[model samples]
Target: MTEVRVGDLAQGFLFRRQAVQLRTELSARGQELSTGRAADLTDRLSGDTARLAALDREVALAATLRRNQAQAANRSAAMQAALGRVQSATEPLATTLRSAAAGGLAGELAAAGSAARGAFEDTVGALNQSTAGRSLFAGAATTGPALAGADAMLDTLRAEIGAETEAAGVAQIVEDWFAPGGGFDSSGYLGADSPASPVPLGGGDQAALDIRADAPALRQVLAASALATLAADAALNLPEDTVRALFDTAAEGLGSAGPQLIGLRADLGAEEARIERAGARIEASAGGARRARASLIEVDGYEAATRMEALSQKLESLYAVTARLSRLTLLETIR
Candidate 1:
C-alpha cells in the first residue's frame, strides 16, 4: 500500500468540520420530523419554488384581509355604540320638550331648553367618538373629532339665529345650517367632505361604514336641539308662547328622528354580521392555502423521524471521536 500520512492539524480540522455539518443536519432533520415539512424546499422540490411562492402570497393576503375585517368590525361596533348614545340622548329630550310644550309653565319650558342643550352636548360627544385614536364619524378625515365641541357648534348656530325668535325663522335657520352645503358641513362639522371608503372583507363583500357627523338623521336631532336652545336663550328674552312653540317644534322634529336612528343602528348590525361571515370564509381561505403549501413541502413523518435519528447517532459518534482525539497529545499523535 502506498504510504499515506495525514497531519494531526489537518485531521483535527476535518473532524471538526464534519462534526459541525452533522450537528447542522441533525437540527434540520429534527425540525422536519417535528413539523413534517422539509427544511430545504429548494433541495426537496428540485429547485421549483413558484408554487410555494404563490402559496406564500396567498397566506399573506389572507392574513391582510383578516386584519381588514377586524378593523372594520371594531370601527362599525364603535359607530354603533355612538349612534346608540345619540338615540338614547335624543329620545329623552323629545319627551322632555313635549311634556313642557303640552301643559307646562315657562320655567318648565326653559328647563326643557337646558335639557336640550345637555342632549345636544351628548349627541355631539357621541358623534365625536374615536376608536384607536381615530375619529369614528369623521369620514375620511379620521385624525380629528367628527364635529366641533358642543359649545362651538352651538355658537355657530347662535350666530345664524342672530336675534331671531320666531318659531319658523329659527326652524328654517337650523334646517339651513345643518342642510347640505351649510354651516354644519362648513363649520360645526369638521370631518372630511367625502365619506370613508368601504372596507374589503373578502369574498367580494365590503363593510361600508359611511355614517358621518353630517348624516341626515344626526342633523335632524341637532337641529331640534338648536331650535330649542335658541328659543330659551335668556339673551333673546322671548315670550313664553314663542318659546313653547319652539319647544314643540324641537320635540316633534326629534320624535320623527327615532326611527331613522334605529335604522342606522340596524344597518351597522348588518355590516357586523357580514364581517363575521367574511371572517369564516377568510379562515377557510387561509386554511386551504396552508394545506396546499403543506402538500408541496411535507415529508413522510416516518422517513423524517428515521433520518433525524440517524443524524443524531452520527453526531454523537462524531462528538465521541472528537473528544477522544482531543485527549491524544501532540507527542502521542507524532509517535
Candidate 2:
C-alpha cells in the first residue's frame, strides 16, 4: 500500500470531529444513567412509533378516567350520606304519625305535627347539601339548591290544597302536586328535569351519578310530610274524627314512604359499588399502560451503566488523541 499523509489542518479537523462525537455519546450515556430512560424515544421506537403513541394515549385517557371516577365516587358517597340523614329525619316523624293514628290526644297529635315540620326542614336541608360546592341532588343543576326553601315549599302545598274540606281532597291535591311531572316540578324542586350524564370510567364502562329532589321516593316522603303540616293546621277547624282520619292517612302514607326511601338508598348503594369496581379496573389498566410505555422508552440500569463506562473510556481516549495531535505541530514533525 502507498504511504498516505494527512496535513496538519486535516488532522486537527479529524481530531476535533472525533472529540465532538465522543462527547455527544458521553452526554447521551450520562442522561440515560441519570434518568434510567432512553434519551430519545423516537430512536428507541426504531421507526415504529405507532404502538408507543397508542400506549401513551391510553395512559393519558386512563388518567382522565381515574379523575372522573374519583369525582363520581365522592359525590355518590355524599348523596348516600344525605339520604341517610333524610331517612333518619323521616323515620321519627313516621313513628310519631303512627302514634297519632293510634288515637293520640290532640296535644300528642299537635306534638307529632311539630315533629313532622322539623323532619321536613331537616329533609330539605339534606336534599340541598353540597359536595365540593356542587349540589348533591340538583341533577344537572349542580350549582344551586335542589329544592326550594322549606317555607316556600310548604306555602306552595298549602296554596295547592286551598279550601279542600276533607282528607281525600287534601291527599289528591298533594299527589297532583308532588307526583312526577306535577306542581312540585314548578314549585318545590328547583333542580333540572334531566339528570346529569353518567360518569365514564375507562374500558367503555360508566357509572350513574344521578340524584334529584323530585325523585319518586323523595316526593313520597315530602308529600307525606306536607300533608302532616296541613293536618296540624286543620286540626283546629276540623272535627276530631276528621282530624283522626287525616292523621291515619298521613301515617299510612309515611309507612309506604319509608320503603320508597329505602329503595332509593339501595339504588344509590349499588351505584357506589359499581363506581368502586370501575375505579379498580381503571387503575389496573392505567398501570399496564404505564409499564408498556416504560418498556418502550426506559433503559435497563445495568446495561446503561455498562454503556456509560464504555463511553467514558472512549471519550478519555479521544481527548488524549486530540491533545497529542495539538502538541505535534509541523515544526515538531520536521524536527
Candidate 3:
C-alpha cells in the first residue's frame, strides 16, 4: 500500500473545499448579475413611456380647449360692449321722451328723435360687427359680413316700416318695429324669423356664428332698437307730447333689457373662471403623471454602485483562494 502523505491529503482537501467555495460564490454572483428584477424594471419603464404619451395627448387637448375658451370669452366681451353703447344711446332718448310727454318744445323733440335714429343705426351696425376679420353673429359663416349688404338690410327695414304704417298707424308701426322678430335673425341676416335656421354669413347657407340662438338680452336689444327707429320717424308727424310718449316707450324697452345683459355677462364671467380652474387641474394632473412615470423608469445610481462593488470583492476573494491552492505542494510542505 502506498503511504498517505499528510501534506498530500491536506493539500487535496484544502484545494477541493476552496474549489467548492469558489463555485458557490461564482454561482451566487452569477445569480446576482442575472437578476430578472432588471427586466421587470425595463418593462415598467416601457409602461411609463406609454402613460407619458397619453398624458402628453391630454395636455395638448387641454391647450386647445383653453384657446377655444379664450375666443368665446372675447366674443362675449364684445357683445357686452355693444350692449353698453345701446344703453348709453337709450338713456338720453328716454329723458327727452319724458320731457316731451310733459309738453316741451317741438324743435327740441325732433332733434331728440333725430339723435335716437342715429343711435339706432349705430346699434344695428354694432350687431353686424366683426372681430379678427370674422363676423361675430355669422354663425359658422366666418368669411365676411353676416348680411348681403348694409343698404339691402336698410331697405328691408324700411319695407317692414312701410307695411306697419299701412296696417295700423304710426303707433302700431312703432309697436311692430319693437316686435320680437325685429332685427336680423339669429344667423345675423335679415328675415331670419326662425331661430333654428339662422342666415348664413357671406351669402352662403353655412351657419358660422356661435352666439346662442335664444340669447334674451341680444334679442330684446334688437327689438328695442327697431322700435326706437320707428318711434323717431313717427315723431315727425306727431305733436311734441305724443312723440315724447313713443320715445319714452322705446327707451323703456331698451332699459328693460339692460339687467338681462348684466346677468348674461355674469354668466360668461363664471364660465371663464371654470375654464381657468379646469386648466390648472389639467396641468397638475400632467405633472403628477410625469413624476410617477419617472419613478417607475429611473434607476438608483447609488444602489447599483454598491452592488457592483460587493460583486467585485467576492470575485477577487475567490481568485486569491484559487491562487493559494495552486501553489500548495507536498514536497515544499515536507521540508
Candidate number with greatest TM-score: 2
Candidate no. 1 TM-score: 0.84
Kindly report which residue stretches of model 1 are placed more than 4 angstroms away from their true locations once superposed.
1-24, 31-36, 298-303, 314-335
The model with the greater lDDT, 1 or 2, is: 1
Per residue, candidate 3 scores C-alpha lDDT tens digits across 1-335 of 54677996897687668667756654544553555224344365655566656756765654555455455546556655655665676556666556654565766666766666666666566656776665655556555554444344445555655633332255565444334564455223542322223322121212212453236676566555555454556423444445566666666766787788677656656545654555465457557755665565454555545665675676578667767756757676587
TM-score of 3: 0.56
- Looking at model 1, residue 192 earns an lDDT score of 95
- lDDT rank order: 1, 2, 3
Q: Candidate 1 has which clashing residue pairs, if any?
A: none
- Per-prediction TM-score, please? 0.84, 0.87, 0.56
Evaluated at residue 146, the lDDT of candidate 1 is 88
**By TM-score, how accurate is candidate 2?**
0.87
Give the deviation of candidate 3 from the true structure as CA RMSD.
11.9
Per-residue lDDT tens digits for candidate 1, residues 118-156, read: 888899999988998889999999899988898887777
For model 1, give the RMSD to the true fold.
4.6
- Given candidate 1, what's the lDDT at residue 274? 92
Residue 114, candidate 2: how far off, in angstroms? 2.4
The number of the candidate with the highest lDDT is 1
Candidate 2 per-residue C-alpha lDDT over 1-335 given as tens digits, one digit per residue, 9 for 90 to 100: 53346776687788788878878887998899899899878888887999988998999999899999999999999999999999998887777887886889989878877888888898899999999899989889989999999888877777777777687877788778887788789878998988978888877788787878888888888888877877787533555565567777777777888888898889999999999999989999999999998989899989988988998898788788778866676678798
